[model samples]
Target chain A: MYRTLVGIGLICALVIVTVFEVTFPIIKVNKQRALENAIYQVLANTKSFSAYHLVGNNNLQKVTDNDTSDIYACYDANHSLIGFAIAAQGMGYQDTIALLYGYSIRSESIQGLVVLQSRETPGLGSKIESRAFLDNFNNIEIGLDAIDNERQQPLELIKNNSKTHTRQIDAITGATISSRAVVVILNRSLSFWLPIVAKQQEPIT
Target chain B: MSTKPGEIIVTGPKDTDEFIKGVWAQNPVFVQVLGMCPTLAVTNTASNALVMGLATAFVLLMSNVLVSSLRHAVPKQVRIASYVAIIATFVTAVDYIIQAVSLEVHKSLGAYVSLIVVNCLILGRAEAFASKNNLKRSIYDALGMGVGFTLALLCLGVVRELLGNGTFFNLSVLPGNFQPWVIMLLPGGAFFVLALWMLLINRLKQGGPRD
Candidate 1:
């Protein structure tokens, strides 16, 4: 009995490993293409982009795509830098919501946002991906006004489109929690990433 | 399986009956109502349903072939474990293949592709049919069942996408002025569509006058 079980296990493992090896390269290519497309979408008019990875918590280094998470510096057709595309994720209504957004240091605001991976409630909480809600992130202020290594004012969530400030994200009518969830995700992501990004401080001018 | 005249009149372990029964007589979705998790969750679009169906079928076919080939070697006590492991291997393969083929379809299917390992239909076949049958018979059975499962998902996908979104396979079929049925796109809509399909299949079965 033991021998037979071991035999089956061996065969199964062999087949799986073989399949994984055969398809690994192709899967990697597909994923890389998808990320590039998302970066382009969020950054707008980005004809190309260069990949970078942060060493430890501070030093951002340019690197080729591998297992390491990449932060993209988007460029236009003339190879001039447009902005940066950063990836972030946190808990949403249903599952982890992985997001990508473009940040313009010049404007001190986010250029655009895309829900890279979302399992929020369809038709309800899922509205975070809707154009009406995502438009909130387009050029919205994050105002890098740091005081003693902390944001002077963290991003805020408001309702009824009565936002008193630029960085304040408005909660949509139907997807209030989901909208807040995105903001919460963004806030957490920004608190960690923005400081690192601000230190690099390379203006595209 | 059925005493009827040309009405699913097919039964035998080695012949085409192994294939035919799964399509008409023993459909995993309509007749057995197995794998409701994906059947309900991802069938929101016809294209999603088609891709899912193909993935499930591939897993089923490969697992069934593996299980049947090893049936005699595996002991009764660990049979279920062996079957599950086999099914899961194929499911992983399908998941990777889908991811490589199209990222959008993979996203739409989400974790349901991984969920195929837990699907009772594949396991049930490994236990009940494949274990006792020969390799040739299992192949027919898997293909038939695969086609049947795909067709069933397509059925629900077509209706749901059409009524709910006023489209089929993302193509606009309904008139421009047609008001979409909002309920057909919700989680609740899956139950409604499934119940309707079950009703239709069973009713048709009973309505066969010459059977």
Candidate 2:
């Protein structure tokens, strides 16, 4: 009995170790490439980007330490700042929706949105990744307050085709919860980062 | 190996019988009703269903081959544990492979891919078929079962995608005015479709209509 158990254990260990060694590098490269692509995708018109951490009280701290909340400063072809891409997460219909979106400091609006990860229900909630839904973020104004404390107009999801307000997003039909979740996530993320972004100058990279 | 009383021993594989049984008589989803979780969860779209079915089939085939090859060496007492470990190793390998292929599909499949480790279909095959069979027969059994599973999933997926989204494989198949049955895209719809498939299969098995 003892010998049999040990043999099984050894076999399992060998298989696992062999597979891990073979696949780990490919998985790593794939993930890194995806991350880079997502960063560039969200912040369009970007020539390059520099990573920075958001430290205490939403300060733009240098990227000396590895943190999940690190923001990317996007630069244009002339090496001038275009915007910043920040990662955000919030509750969706079935799971937490994690995404990265670009914010244009000059226009005080979101440049674009890209879903990094979402477990939203297929055919409905998953429409959050649809071009129609994501296009709603393009140049949508997120006005900063006098004290830069709050957004002048909070993001809202209206029924599809009835969107009138600059802050309103046309929600996907039958996916109200998921559409609302995206709006809520955008609002929450903007509330935290917009103020800091508005106050800070382009960091020396 | 001595057969105990009432322990109906599986005979040496007659290639075609092993293969065809899985496709029709012993269809995992429609007939034997195994692996319901993935069958219902990922069948909302044909593409998602196809990818998921293929992934499960890959794991099933690899695990069956490994289990059959190791059957002689593994002792009866620890066989189940050994089988599970073997299945899990394959699942992890496929998981990484899918992640490398497409992050979108990987995310869509999500935890369901990992959950394949616990899928009774793969384990059931390993224990009931592979453990008692030789490698070549086990491979044939795995292939048939895998293909059967994929076909069953495709049926559900095609029906659901066509009715729920008015699209098949993401292309609009139904007329523009045709309103999609939103219910067909939800979890409740999955149960309805599977139940209907089972009912249809049962009726066919019973032959001409009977009160």
Candidate 3:
């Protein structure tokens, strides 16, 4: 039994390790490219991007990989900051929806939204990634006064095409939970990240 | 092996029943009702179901091949653990391959891809058939079961996607005014469809209570 067990263990390890080694580089490149594309997409007109990590409450330091929140700063062709792309995740109808959105400091508005990952039901909640649903993020001023660490008004979820208020976002007809999830996640992410971003506001140029 | 035509023949007349048995008689989904979790969960869309079916079949084939190849070396006492380890290696490999292939497919499959390791159908075959049979027969058995499983998933996927969303593989198939049966996309919808498929298949194979 011991010999058989050991032999099996060795074989399993060898096979798994071989497959993992061969595929790891390809998987890494795929994920890295996807994230870069998402950042560029959310922050439209972005030519290049850099990621910054929060250090000791307020200090912004450049990082390659981080477990804690790392905000990506997107720059235009002139190397001027266009906006910041922040990733946030929250529970949707079936699973957690991970998304990246661009927030413009100069205009105090959200630029765009892109779903990084979502496992919602097809033809329903998955519509969150639909172009029509995502278009809701185009140029809605959040009135962010990062100096005070607060948003002038909280984002609201309204019926599709019932956008009478500037703060109201239209939820997909059949994907209410999944649509609202984006709003709720953005709200939480903004509250947490905007303050930290404010501390080192300068030198971002 | 190269000179003999029979060596590589997939569906030779002599052993054609070996393949047909699993495709019809002992089907993993429609007849045996094995791996109900994926059958019920991922069949909401035709594309999702097709990709999932192919992925599962890939894993089944690889695991069966390995298990059959190593049958003699794996002692009876620790056979279950050995089989699980072999199965898990392939599942992880499949998961990574799928992710590398398309993040969309990876996200759609979600955790179900990882959950393939625990599938009763794969393990049951490993223990019952692959362990005892030679590689050739084992390969045939796996191919038959894999095709049967994929066909079953496609059946459920087509029915659900058509009635629930009025679309087949995300393409609109019905007129604009067709109101979809919303419940067909939910968990209850899967049970309704599976029960109906079972009733239909049972009626065709009528011979009293199924053994």
Name the top DockQ candidate: 3
Q: What is the lDDT of residue A89 in candidate 2?
A: 92
Candidate ranking under TM-score, highest first, comes to 3, 2, 1
lDDT of each prediction vs. the true structure? 0.82, 0.81, 0.82
lDDT of 2 by residue, B1-211 (tens): 0112112323534664677667667889988899999998888889989998898899999889988998888889889988888888888888878887777788777788998898899999999999999998888789878888888888889899999999999899889999878778887899999999888877876886998
Comparing 2 and 3 on DockQ, the stronger one: 3
Q: Which residue pairs of candidate 3 clash?
A: none
- Candidate 2 scores an iRMS of 2.1
Q: TM-score of A-chain in each prediction? A: 0.81, 0.85, 0.87
When candidate 1 is compared with the true two-chain complex, its DockQ is: 0.51
RMSD, each candidate, Å? Answer: 4.1, 5.5, 4.6
Worst 10 residues of 3 chain B by lDDT: B1-10
lDDT, residue A33, model 1: 89
Name the lDDT value of residue A154 in candidate 2: 67
DockQ (C-alpha based) per candidate is 0.51, 0.47, 0.55
* Pairs with backbone N, CA or C atoms under 3 Å apart (clashes), candidate 2: none
